[model samples]
Target: MSESSDGAKDPSAGTLYPGESPRVYRALFNIFPPYLFGGVRVRHIADDWTSVRVTYTVRPWNRNNPNRAAFGGTLYSMTDPFFGIMAYGQLGRDYRVWNTVGNIEFIAPGRGTVTAIMELSREQVDAIRDATRDGGKSITDHAAEIRDMQGNLVARASQKLYARRLRR
Candidate 1:
């Protein structure tokens, strides 16, 4: 892993900082105002950037008036960012990646803590690399589900991402 001038591992260096990267990112996300106030917490990020787990707690500040359930926006926000980050990290500095669009469908009211697990397979990474190898662009869709502590599905989300090789 590469270190910055200040001695902290440089996350943009396309290498894992062992146990540090995930913890650093998790801390950053947890303290981010939007996520902090919304009761969204990032629980884990795989060292290889293959998966992420996030939790959304239903709090008075983030509950819907109708039933004191988790707000739809908070649920959706919990599903955002992971896929793009995974793809970007897995694809490395040679490629450009972005989350072009996102959508969420509520299946049930989330009254307590809900979790979303996002995953990207090696096959998916290979496919994206193949599609963008010749300086071509590829648009792919990724999905995740938010489930309550009881393992009941509370929401489903999809993100459309765009990737292209950066000309060297």
Candidate 2:
């Protein structure tokens, strides 16, 4: 029940203990092809979380603002779609999962190569499985953040997943 600076439950505490193996993170990257941006590379992944760091190059489509910065939508789109994937991966085959809804906040223009980190807890995973098993309906909420190479917050996303226990 660790809490974040915002006073909500800390998302990374249980799923990723300190110094966990990188192999686990690599496996998570494979689960969601959508999160794998064409040029993005996963610098580190651990616990039940993954982080993708982007390397920038000059591209006409990426330049949206007068400053020749990365388009805000491009930045957000790059940051999206990973939380639900990680949540389902953590839940394993015990339940069927799908993204239901999401909300995003863009804090600053993405100027350089960026990073998106997604995480979920073991308790959250179990709750989704149990809720679906017991009530036939499960709604789970998860969050993620995108940051710049220097670790400045660039975008935040919150996701809701609808899950159901698969009938064998």
Candidate 3:
């Protein structure tokens, strides 16, 4: 069994090479409805599933606010899928992971394009693995700060996911 950076066995490695399926998944997910409708674009998905970046562009129809800012809904929508998707990719099919909770805080009016970076560190992954090793589920929370082109904070989002090992 191949070991991940966190020293957990890669349960799906026998079928898919590292980063193979998820790369395709990331590509296809970019055009999915929530992202397409919100004018959100995925900038990148790192090979190891450690980092994913998303960008949102302000479009005319989506902006009706006084300042013509990017809709807060769009900002929130751009972040909706990352945590769940990343968890599935990282944990593979051997682990059942679901995004159980979510929330967003608008920090400022967003104009032009904004980016959100979601990262899952090895330490965090390891902690989750430890928590779920006893066959019970674990809830893990991840957060990201969305920033404007000028690197100013535009929003803060948190996602909580439930993960547990699957039985054959």
Candidate 4:
């Protein structure tokens, strides 16, 4: 993403670090602008994946059950975008990737910074091709977890990504 502040110099030169996905996630984040339940930032993206960290703040409107904790939906939303982004990064510049299905389980109340880590293995990418070998769309399962600042599991989500080779 363009971290360029007002009238400031552009650092990082728009180059994706080696071993990192070459897409600008923060720009993509602004495009689909989530309510940003908290001060979330894309800390690092590499190996065809990205990790975002959420900062906690007390906001009255976020309380869904009068427990005044971070809502479950907020945690789920943090994980939703990773599947698509990670898949695309692996598919490189040759395929189209979309989320076909997803399910999330809330394990605990999130009251502090949470980090969502996502990645797709080499095996998963090979499986995608094997499943779509007949030229039909293929579904590959992927999973992500949200961990609290103390490295405690807060939520887990699994999704099926639909992938297809782009027609040249």
Candidate 5:
């Protein structure tokens, strides 16, 4: 776990600082222990931390469901960390961010490998900054879709985040 080149700390479980290479954030995410055990791999992330793609393969340990489908818990868990992580990265060090709410709907049973992509657009980031610029906190909702290898939607999740600037 190296710090970003801009000397920005990744807020414990966070991403590289602005102007820092995307590779550093990717490396930190790839080696995350829960991701490794869950077979969830981050496929890509835009340099500005606006978007992230992740893939999860069902393994024997995680296939303990009665139908041998990917466990709903694992599906939910895979989407859990990305939002707050991304916000902290893009919002910079002067702010505090936390992934406060998560809800998932299992649309279809998932077998084999699956993928979920989480993205926070530049406009959205700007909105958050604007909403919180006065040091007031903001709570916002974000969504991600988890699809199976066949391009079928298996689950959808809504994650709400809390963000506010640290009062000096």
Candidate 6:
């Protein structure tokens, strides 16, 4: 397990919900209305909240009209939220974290299932914590690649997360 300078464990070593297991969280996230409707599923969330893997499928209802590929919005949605959640979990309850910006560039038409794996390294969590230690705000950028089952890149997504220590 990785530790921060302030002795906080790595993102993978912390839980978003105090007593809930990661598996349970993943299950709940999979059924979230937006994800369910968009054919996005949370396949796995690391035990410590450091990493997440999500899958988006191009079903008939979710496919684009002309190309019949995965919808761009859904692909972008699959890359959203995970980074902020990881940063918040690693930073603990005293800090606020939010995704400030998100962008996606489509590399190919996703005709089948595409997976997005998002991870926050211990170094990244520590950097965010250090940057906001004086209660000032910090923004960290993260990137993820959405890949098809055959390992072909389908899209590249980037997210900027803002973090600040909450004033007591």
User: Per-residue CA lDDT of candidate 6, range 1-168, in tens?
Assistant: 457567876553355456666688788888899998889999888877789999998888889979999999999989788898777767776778898888999999997899999999878987886898787899988999999999999999999999997797
Compute each candidate's TM-score over C-alphas: 0.86, 0.64, 0.86, 0.71, 0.84, 0.89
Q: Write the per-residue lDDT of candidate 1 for residues 1-168, one digit (tens) a residue.
A: 334346786444444335446668788899999999888999998887789999988988789977989988889898788887888777766678889999999999998899999999767977887797677998999999999999999999999989897896
Top candidate by TM-score:
6
On a 0 to 1 TM-score scale, where does candidate 6 land against the true structure?
Answer: 0.89
Worst 10 residues of 6 by lDDT: 9-18
lDDT of each: 0.84, 0.58, 0.78, 0.62, 0.79, 0.85
Model 5 over residues 1-168: C-alpha lDDT tens digits?
223336664353233455455577667767988777778788887777778888889977877568888888888877787787778777777778888788999999888999999988766766777788677889999999999988999999898899997786
The clash count of every prediction, one per candidate, is 0, 1, 0, 0, 0, 1
For model 4, the run of ten residues with the poorest summed lDDT: 1-10
Instruction: Give model 6 RMSD, 1 decimal.
Output: 2.8
lDDT of 3 by residue, 34-91 (tens): 7777778888887777788989888786664687998877887777777766666666
- Candidate 1 lDDT score at position 18: 56
Q: Between prediction 1 and prediction 5, which has the larger TM-score?
A: 1
Regions of model 1 farther than 4 Å from truth: 1-20
The residue pairs in collision within model 1 are none
Model 5, 109: alpha-carbon shift in Å? 1.2
- Candidate 2 C-alpha lDDT tens digits along 7-88: 6863443343444344665555444454354334555555443333333332455466486666655565554555555555
Identify the superior model by lDDT, candidate 3 or candidate 6: 6
Best by lDDT: 6
The CA lDDT at 26 in model 1 is 83
Q: Provide the lowest-lDDT 10-residue window in model 1.
A: 10-19
Q: What are the RMSD figures for all models against the true structure?
A: 6.1, 8.2, 3.1, 9.7, 5.7, 2.8
